[model samples]
Target: MKRALPLLIFMAISGAVFSQENPIGIFEDNKDIGNPKLAGSASYDETSQTYTIKGAGYNIWGQRDEHRYLYSKVKGDFVATANFEFEGNKEIHRKIGWMARASENDNSVMVGGFLHGDGLMAGQWRERKGADMQNPEDDVWAQKRYQQIIQLERRGNTFIVRAAHPGEPLQEISSKQLEFMPEAVLLGVVIGSHDENVIETARVWNARIDQPVAEDYNPGKDGWIGCRMETMNVFDGKRRVIHEKDGRFEAPNWMPDGKELLFNEDGSLYTIPINGGKTEKLNTGSADDLNNDHCISFDGKMLGISHNDGEGSNVFYLPLDGGEPKSVTQQAPSYLHGWAPNNKEVVYVAQRGENKVYDIYRKPIKGGKEVKLTDNKKWDHADGCEYSPDGKYIYYNGSKNGGTMQIWRMKPDGTEKEQITFDQYNNWFPHISPDGKWIAFISFSPDIELNSHPSYKKVMLRLMPTSGGAPKVIAHLYGGQGTINVNSWSPDSKHIAFVSNSKKSVKVD
Candidate 1:
């Protein structure tokens, strides 16, 4: 179906006022290219922080092509991401997504992380001007007609394409080395009809362009980085960075009231307004050296903290309002992760006695002998264990293949253990939702070592049903250790709080 472009209405939105001189001020520049009967338009919705674009042009294919493009000029390496979908099923080949081009000419060399109207999502590229189109091998193809989370990045000469359904991690769909391409080029969202006479409309929401470090770059050592407290809607996969700081902060614990977040920095725990604000320290008396492992009990009366007490790590309980901490687990190297529903017991991962092997243990808050739930061999280790909301099972991560770490669940008594997740990456921290209907966990890259959960890597926060199913990536971020060490799901289970790190001065309220 064809539509008139001029009839499309474009609205400017943001905390900053946008005028004719500041068209889509978020980007360096943009244009609706290709001669068409109707001009394309872009609109921003302040409430949702989303962009809507309507355009008309011929197919962006063949020896040469035409299409309405919304672009920004950029130089050097960059990462661009957006959640996109067409306005309607106007045409089967209608295309919309992130694009990187060497030039605006129809025959320009380019690569696209695209979602097509026919539900054919692909990473398509043109090697050079007027060249034949080529796509990645079969291993990377994925499809869906609805909204897609697309990411396109350029690292040196390598062009990497990633995309996925919202609430899922972006999978690497295509990668190509374009050595001849210029250091600077045009990049942004694009729309095309696949037929010159036809006009198609679409949207690219929460679009972000990140200037990241080299793949070999090690953050902090190479350069100091800041952190952002981020929350995502579990159902829609919409993300918002609620707070940011000049230095690193880790392990967000959403308060029971949902009005604030508890995070740790410089060995001290602090609370910040959920909407973003100044940080105030929470006194723990003499228990300092707090790590990222911390959680609020189901009753919301006490906080379980993993504190380094000079001897080593141990679990401690303190009043939610901040007071003298009471030691719960006297065993050193014990990292507290979850609190039982009754709030009388705490689950932790520790290397007790001379074992030197980490395993899940259930320790009574009132003091009792620790119960070891895993007695696997020396090569085996377990971590990220927490009681199910219903208090029937304890979910944790273990190497089911004796190499690849998979999510596992067992009775609280350590019986009937079974693997719940089977995939490429090392999945950890299975934090069940308050309602017990969903499970959220952190997933490391497949290239990472089997047992290590390191920081400063590209990782995915994924979601799945509590009963078990294929997991979906909810957030792609540069974080690991401090990202999600505890159950951070909101009380209502509609949202989740986590942390992301970056060297850039990106700010979002």
Candidate 2:
């Protein structure tokens, strides 16, 4: 969660209009401006200062006779505006401005303000019950000029739609209508042509929406609310340090008894009490070169770690009370990825050959031949493997489509594989909630390059339900390598324990 402190304060002073050029809460499409992913014959012409939308045919969603525009992921109170002129015949049945909150299936709660070719302006709210509630006629039909401005404002679940002629005050087109106000929505400007003729042009400029001023906007709070780099000290509510360090500390897996946190610090495994005290190094000795990936057995007696020992990294098991680690994999190059709910089998990434491509493999902790789970020609690069609380499925990250990684769940045998995340962001290190209803993982925005090496200064932790939905960012902190020490879930599932880093001085001795 990243905070917008200055913007919040600025929004307070100007009724949320912090800037004239780009208001705080509004997003606009000038056709000339913004990154456009336009569909159909809609194209922006900067030279003519217009956006030409040609209606060659009718689209099933009432778009063929209409020119459609789309903007996604809008939240909270906002205003949308557009300017346009019609050049073709008056056969166009509907010219309208629309605001919609679309669901995953594209079904939406649509607010439509339409102007007929005969010069009648009408507005209505489109619901599942069919387009019902229509507003009383104002001046929408009386004007001859094609130029217009349209605006939509939202508060809670209610939306207020308005429109006006050029140089005219915005008149209320519709009153507060109850609708499903999405946390994020899509805004669009549409023009309908009843005939095959083209709708001449729509030009949008100085269009913006601003968010209402919020009272709280601290940078630290912003880090928690937005994706901003900061530090979060993972402590037991009583201020007991589970895993503390100067750099990135991550993946704090709790012992079955919930007494200590199994975490990684500086690429090695360590344990700290729940009450916060000195960290005891888990002396893997030669297996000390470990990564952040580690977990404890269901019985809490054995600890499995992915570590490098002279030859290469592989899964190794040691006693929870600290002892010499015994290598579990016979293969030369394998890295531990996940532990089964039974704690008897461990899943890891196995490199094939000189090509360096990797896939997921599983083996028993009691020393058995490895079983290949995924075998894609391209690198599978499976990670964050964990069995569901009921031991029904194994959730992990897989790179099957090109090189982009996505969350995937498969049966323990590697069958029934399905992609979970569809967003453009990079989601990794999935930790399933103990109750099996949610998954928490690290999310890197499109701004963060995928191939870029992990650094402590940029990254965010996000949460999404295992049932499938948009991921919500939960923590904005500067640590990625070992952000979550292990599967340290609270008994109530209300909180999670993960390690993060800051520059503040501390005495490690």
Candidate 3:
């Protein structure tokens, strides 16, 4: 009996930690043990990627009564995040945050990192089954404030909670140990109305769930997992995932008519509805090996493609509606980036000299000798080069004086070279919006090498005024390479489209 007891305990712990039955997507609202009269509603916004929970419950503490829960059943270590807030003025105790619990029971063993309407944020929990919840161990309490970014991470047997205001990273607030809770538990966005008769809905935005991965995991051999095609309302801070797939897709460019989005998958180009639907193959005739570096001209009448399947990249021009592609650049390793204001000339980055230096070059659409715009002494690497909207300047990214890559711009005539951004992080692809009011670019962390922007790393999409100013983070995502290789700003200049990756582990249902 003694030997058998130890074996039984080990098996029980193993089952809790490594269960494969996980629901790995957005979920609506459901009650644990609440009054049938107290209703709750939940929804996920496909445009802004926000979640809302309209819940009515007395309280989630003090042995529990009624509340709404929207959760995913995850078994292994994971990180969950949300921007949490209440709809309007309400009672001080109205709560909404993130939770991890063993079950939906009213008195289930659980821990919650929640924010109260009265401006109190806490890490509350129940020690035993059906036990009354204890006070949180938060170091400080606010009288009334909303935590815009809330994160809950499970590291082995310990759970850590953190929250911060918008445009800021989550900072640690509290940590708890719940060794008794099952390893396979429900954890996600949570909300409680506090007053069962009056449902003060809770709002959450940028809901993300990242599963644990090895430090050296390879996406090619391990295979890519979940990918979401997302759009962002740059002005209002709203984002949503419109389409999700099991593998990889790259660089979505808004269609000319604004009815669809064109992206690259495998080695071909495809178009899906602007919002999301069945994707149709955009036949490029013989240009089957198109890369993500493709874009439409200002007049929206022509398309440029960079085909890099065989030896080196070949730049081609074709009709916007897809037709027989005509070769544009005579060089072997040229990439198409931008078109002149009148659509009469095309600009790209290519190797022109015996040094194999990557520099900006321009060629007339009606057939002319290629003109090199940038003539520097060293640094064989310069990329993300493109022409400004009005054709006044050419924006590109490269390191100067052997420093970090900075956003630089020069006159279309290749004179008056100047730097735009000077920061510690390596920035790339200074894409100008339609109205020419803002510049959206991708930034990699300082820890990474200056010349590398690898895939599946934590990266940020930052926006700055085109004239130049402080950059603000518009989106924090787990994507690189295919996220935004080309200009994807909508025609109205209100939104931008990009791609983010994830390793989804979904339940079979």
For 1-509, candidate 1 gives per-residue lDDT tens digits of: 00000000011122222112324635544566556566777777755667788887776766565677766666677777778878777788888888888876778788787788887777777777778664333114565535478888888878898877766556687887876677777777888887667778887775666555455555435544566677888888777766766566788899999899998887789999877778889988898888888889999999988889988888899999899899987768888889999999999988877777788899899889899988866768798899988999999988733688789999999999998888888898889999999999999988876577766567788999987689987777667778887789998999999977643332211
Clashes per model (N, Cα, C within 3 A): 3, 26, 6
RMSD (CA, Å), each prediction: 8.0, 19.1, 7.8
Off by over 4 Å in 3: 1-25, 33-50, 56-66, 105-112, 121-144, 154-164, 167-183, 194-198, 351-357, 375-381, 503-505
Q: What's the C-alpha lDDT at position 447 in model 2?
A: 58
Give the winner by lDDT: 1 or 3.
1
Candidate 3 pairs with clashing backbones: 16-183, 48-239, 48-240, 49-239, 49-240, 119-144
User: Who is ahead in TM-score, 1 or 2?
Assistant: 1
lDDT scores in order = 0.76, 0.54, 0.74
Residues 1-509 of candidate 2 have per-residue lDDT tens digits of: 00012221001112121122321112232121111123233554433323454332231132112244433335555444454445545464545454544431323445555555555555555444223333342112334434355566666666766666643345666665555545555455554444334433333432333343233434334432111111222221111223333233456776666566667655677677666667777777667677767777766678888777777677899887887888898666776766777878888777766656667788998878888888766444566677778888888776664566677888889999888988766677677767788787776555544422243333456677888888765544344445553466654465667654332211111
What value does the lDDT take at residue 305 in candidate 3?
Answer: 88
